[model samples]
Target: MDRFARIDTLINNARIFISRPSNRDTEGDVTAVLGVNIAGHITQLAAAHDRGGR
Candidate 1:
């Protein structure tokens, strides 16, 4: 935001998912999915909030 002078919008479409149960791993799958879907969104939202974003 500082570099751009203003931030109008923030769009995050990044995600992770396993279609088949057989392809899923115990630790790694849960970690990746939660990291991307939950933790990642929280981090980005925090950043936007700090920058006075809407």
Candidate 2:
């Protein structure tokens, strides 16, 4: 989303490729992958807000 791009320097595969397939999703896929990905992205927004973003 534009929000993430604005707050984060970039979105890297490293963060997306973390949690293994098993731990990543209930179907041993990407259900949790998306969840984890969103969390990482949110961290950036929160940081920016805490730092006082316009």
- Model 1 has a clash total of 0
- Where does candidate 1 have its weakest 10-residue lDDT segment? 1-10
lDDT of 2 at 53: 82
- TM-score winner among the candidates? 1
In model 2, which runs have C-alpha deviations exceeding 4 angstroms?
1-28
Query: Candidate 1 residues 1-54, lDDT tens each?
Result: 457765465566788878878455788888888888886676576577667774
Model 2: lDDT of residue 49:
72
- In candidate 2, position 37 carries an lDDT of 74
Show pairs that collide, candidate 1. none
lDDT over C-alpha atoms for residue 12 of model 1: 69
Q: In order, what is each prediction's RMSD in angstroms?
A: 4.7, 9.2
